[model samples]
Target: MSGREFDLVLYGATGFTGLRTCQYLARNYKQGVRWAIAGRSASKLEEVREKLVNIDPGLSTLSIIQADASSPESLEAMAARTKVVISTVGPFLKHGEPLVAACVKQGTHYVDSTGETPFVLDIIRKYHKEARDKNIILVPECGFDSVPSELGTKMVVDFLRKEYNLPTKSVKLSVTKLRGAVSGGTLASICEVMEGKEGGMKDTLDQNQLVPEDVASKVVPARITLPSVFYDHDFKAWQAFFIMSFANEKIVKRSHGLAVEADGVGYGPEFTYRESMSAPGFFTAALASLGMGLGGAALSVGPLRRFIQNRILPAPGTGPSDESITQGHFTVKIIGESSLPENVPADASADALKPIKAIATIQGGEPGYSETCRYLVEGALCLVQNEDRVRNENKITGGVLTPAYAFGHILIDRLRAQNVNLTVSKL
Candidate 1:
């Protein structure tokens, strides 16, 4: 009998996102690293391995396991052999529940790339209790959808406590920079949900769970969501509508509920930040908003949703090229306000900017896939690597925790080492 078990198993390794995840694992794969490629197709897994072999001959040590998402027995079998299972198989509301159930029941740590907030909320509500008891980490949106943004927000809040004072009056995250196209898979998932093809994620909001349910919900969040037109005192930067409440808003809301120290800060002050890209002409911004308005509306109905998936994305596993993903750029510019006394001078107190602030960006081929693989895997790696002790310490886990709380300085240091753009920027 082979005594070795894989450290991580890449479930759904045959999808577009799955394939990219495998590529990332390959680049970071070490000789003794126990990892495997898994999905419904044996031939496709073999094909991916062959391509990997072309990239690096020594990767022959990589393993393969054929598992079908439809089969719970197969999922449970896959779960037992791995400490952590990072899955890219989504449209999750459609093809996910089985694997998640298996992981939780078997005491395996589970992570997935999902922005379907309602579906995740359902899983947590339905399974978080059991997983918590098992000490299993069931995290979703382990992708560009929110990890870095969530983790970055957590870092800024921690910085406030360590430097200026304990607990930030308020913290905010704005998309100062971001540019990318949605994939077919992304579009397809949206279409299904809009068309009612997606079931099992209806009560995410009332459940009060960001992605998980049954956790205490009275704490403050690390980041706040402001108005579309928040005031930036120093820079006087007036940000336009960056409609991210779709994913980020929910995560931030959950983070507030799961916080350990900043429980008093409340769900961050209302500040909606954005990177207004246009000709600076009123028409341009208006046009963009109109387009978004139309898209947003369509995202909820069957016809418009169907059109996007059919015309825009086209295939379930289709996405941008590796080169395109590698060449993308992302940015965020957030502005915050504090409880200033009457007559707070402008230039006189220019130095007194929101006790805490930060700008974080990750450059990669495809943020949704490539960079997400790096971020989520690193999150899992950080969690497993630094399970004991913390810069703050004495923090409790579970109940919709913040990424910073869950991962901490260990994660920040690791991300910086990976060359992610991180710094304290004003305005």
Candidate 2:
């Protein structure tokens, strides 16, 4: 690690999310954390550094490197120079593979803010074994798309294992509150998914791709239909479709699948996971459901998709005002239901057989922009500082991994220290 020129490198620093991530490093990491910012254009990278200088004058001396995703040699060079590389590049299905390949070749740890499930599944298929062999960690969705779902559920699963000595049968996550603004990068990623291209929305939504191929044929997720509002009496809130559901649900299930393959009792032999947004009331839930359904249907049509691309969504590099970013916040609640082993006595009382429920809440700053930056940078820092713990304690040395599977409690602890509220409780 000491031989590395930089502890970390911020790739795509010229993009909106990347620039904010640089500012975050400047503001938060003042204690000689050797880092650099890299992008396609040297001039643009310097411009971003100048902006960072405004945040911390000392950062004027920060190194700037020019690396383009299209140039495999440039990416390999960047990867070789750093211990970890954090990217805000997306729709990662297009520009992500080169950096990933370079990281594996260089044994550099990699993290990215990508919600594209197909990209993640493809990387797992192509590079998981190589990365494991090289002992280089590759993690994605460090941002809002599925961090809470992955880590929060892990919290619950771990808690159940410790307290009840039981495995989880079902876990449900609901977005109780989410307030954030989107950037052009986010919009572009969404558009690419809905664009009906080769690795587009339809293909990415396949849950079977999320798990290892050996398990993909065996594991079947407990499905929940979207755009149909329903009341979950446990939480006492109306539930509706969440836009990120297509990704998060699969990510959670993948975590379970990997855990099962690693150990006998994963989240559960019959582990099932689902997610939705909680509406204040039935009316609101219905409205949200209807709106999402209509929007999804419209995006599937060519004419409507063109109209959305031209008028409805922001261009790829734009973002919201600082005020909006600051004002943004989100909360997700995960409830894991536990069951006794099959060997339990048949004569057990109904109360004795009642399910044990473990609940966890993951709330933080805006899901998309400010908080996503926080999660990404903190995850990179975790990989840099606690790489040994992740490998030794979690027994996860390398692979294309979900955020929780990669960082686990090491990341949860880091986020809690940064004041991202997370807690587990009995319910």
Candidate 3:
């Protein structure tokens, strides 16, 4: 048993997605779960608690505490009291490090829904070693941003390794169907990237900065251009640039790297990955690609970027209507290609050397908020419930980690229990 007073603490609980997360905990969290709601204002935290009580009247007695990003001491106190922390605070580049620092220092496990590549890379560079020493698991991208891609690919790689006894050589993921809008927090984080910080995505995207030197040296990534659209015969869909690819691809790479360095079970030494969304036809793909390119260009300009951030997008605390949340869903398909063993005879039949493929489908609801809440809350639960398994069975002691690196198949099992559809089959 953890020495902490609480099993979980939901920080930033007054924000749009944060409040939803509290409700999720109230409805689905097991009875006697010791949890609290926290944010900058005591009144706002109380308001959120009241709303949660409406969902589960028993929660009227649930705890509420004050902890602000600007108050490191408060964050420290909050961290010290919880076994695990689930943070929904974002533009994490701007408002996240304090809580992360406190968690690491306090020896608390931490998870967040951050897609800020620069922030994640910084965490890796600065805190991974220390967290490892302290037996702390610091996992980011515990939401829609990259969970499906990171863990979906892991599902494929795991299947291939088990079925054919071979490593995965290359993989492509296509968003086949999506019906969701971005959250205000996610948009804010994207705008923060466009506001142009030094050593931001540019540096993260420069040379696969997410992977360590030793692992990166063994793998060669396929060349991919984000502004281009094309046809993918294998998936039988027109493919277009995916804005989130920069982060998702790098995260999947980090998972593979950890497999080699920590577990010695990898997709292969030369594994490569790319991501795109499937379009109806070539025309739709071309138009979508052009729009994304133009949007990127517009966001890079100071005046346009400010106008979009200030006037057009939702505020950090706001979000789409509840009806929209109910109507939202997403599906992604990952195709994994097999790598031939080195000792295969040169005279082997063409059928023997032909690229074998497996497909993994990951589907869920209301990606930006609802499904994201499930992923985040379930991920936190995985840490709380399976920390010993991750440490002892998986031998994944600690580090700045992707969901797959931190929890392995344990997370997949948790999601399956939550009714998430994760299916894999040979193609």
Candidate 4:
């Protein structure tokens, strides 16, 4: 804790994901990282540090910060010296509140690998005001759940505006393919969230963040059916809601509402975004959707819940190796449609209103934990590189944002440079 505090302090560094992040930092930390690992155990912190040294001898300079989530004081101390804190600890309802409170109180910028919608809603309601008051940014879901979806939306919408000259009406996101080993942390997150939380979590939902007390009170997640015009048309398949739809769409809407040119490619003015899973046919899509819907509905029963618990992801903390991650990749084929709004444009032909085909695909590292870690690590880099980000003495905050708004180009470049080549190409 000398001059320049540290660039980033990785909390929960002993966890599976946190260890991976430290591994990433160690490999790429060619210059002054001014970094340290923080967790409950000094012993585990030292052990992780040794592993880092083994992977990259240049990481010998890495340091440690022993902090307990149970103690607000330790958390505050750890936050005090870091410009940013990337936390991979979760099931947040159980182990997250104290550290979050410390970050808000310390005015340190915070990011987390959490997809727990209820937990995010809780934090937003409870701390958004305090964070705003302190002029800090508490960004959540900088992980696999929403990063691709959010950034993917930005890329597609921007392309439509640039190449097709049309405002977007709606954007759909889905997991095209995901196959990887699971970890205990992932399993724990699934169980805590699937089982639902005590309504006490809602105590943190911020009324003034988006709506007034009166308006926010009645606000609900309004649902809409798929466009009849979309099915059996341009799309080669059917899709359904992503489990983490709440976080991704909400943040996209927030960013769209704040941006001046949100109209051009449907940031918010004429368009909205939804999430889903890609399926080969409508029948398969409906079945998968039903299965997910039923899972949510049935988690409350003891027998069903217990049955799931028995099927823990092939052993917790088990993840793909370096060889696999280096080989894995993803591509998002965005089918962009450009059309003239119907207002009786006399000269407009049906083809003129028809969707002119355009596509964008993002190339990135292999999916699952390693790729998720890569995205997470790159997301932190994006945050650091954002022009919109305003840094002060011991603090850096940004205006309203999603990862794309804050760090899209940086992440793309970094990911590409890291060998996860991405491209915008013809379909």
Q: What local distance difference test score does each model get? A: 0.62, 0.85, 0.85, 0.63
Worst 10 residues of 1 by lDDT: 270-279
lDDT value for model 2: 0.85
Candidate 4 pairs with clashing backbones: 125-204, 125-205, 125-206, 126-204, 183-317, 184-316, 184-317, 240-276, 328-366
Residue-wise C-alpha lDDT for candidate 4, range 370-401, written one tens digit per residue? 66777777776554444244342213343223
Q: In candidate 1, residue 107 scores what lDDT?
A: 71
| Weakest lDDT window of 10 consecutive positions for candidate 4 | 203-212
Give residue 63's lDDT in candidate 3 (0 to 100): 87
List runs of model 3 lying over 4 Å from the truth.
Answer: 30-32, 197-201, 221-224, 263-265, 345-348
Candidate 1 per-residue lDDT, tens place, 1-427, comes to: 0342877788988888888777876777555457788999999999888888876787776788889878899999998898778888878888888888988877777777877766666686788677756666677777776765666666555554445454444445545456566677777666655555334334422323462223343333223323234444433344455554456656655665555234444434332222332224445446656676666566766666666666766698888776777667675543333333335467666555434454333344446766777776776665445545432362544322445556656666777777776665332
Give a tens-digit lDDT track for model 3, residues 1-427.
3688998999989998899888888889749578998999999988898888888988888888899999999999999999899999988999999999999999999999888888898888889899989988999998887899988798888888899888898888999998988777888998887776433335645436677666666667535445678899988999998888878888888888877776554678668888999999999999988998788778778788889888998888888889999999999999999887667798998888776799999999888889888888889988787778877767787888888878768888999998889999897
Arranged by TM-score with the best first, the candidates are: 3, 2, 1, 4
Preferred candidate (lDDT higher): 1 or 4: 4
Cα-lDDT of candidate 4: 0.63
**Cα lDDT of model 2 by residue, 272-316, tens digit:** 887889999999998998898787777777777878988988888
Model 1 ranges with Cα > 4 A deviation: 1-4, 196-238, 260-281, 335-365, 389-402, 425-427
Sort by lDDT, best first: what order? 3, 2, 4, 1
- Residue ranges of candidate 4 with Cα displaced over 4 Å: 1-3, 163-165, 197-221, 224-232, 240-247, 257-266, 281-287, 310-328, 336-345, 354-358, 385-401, 424-427
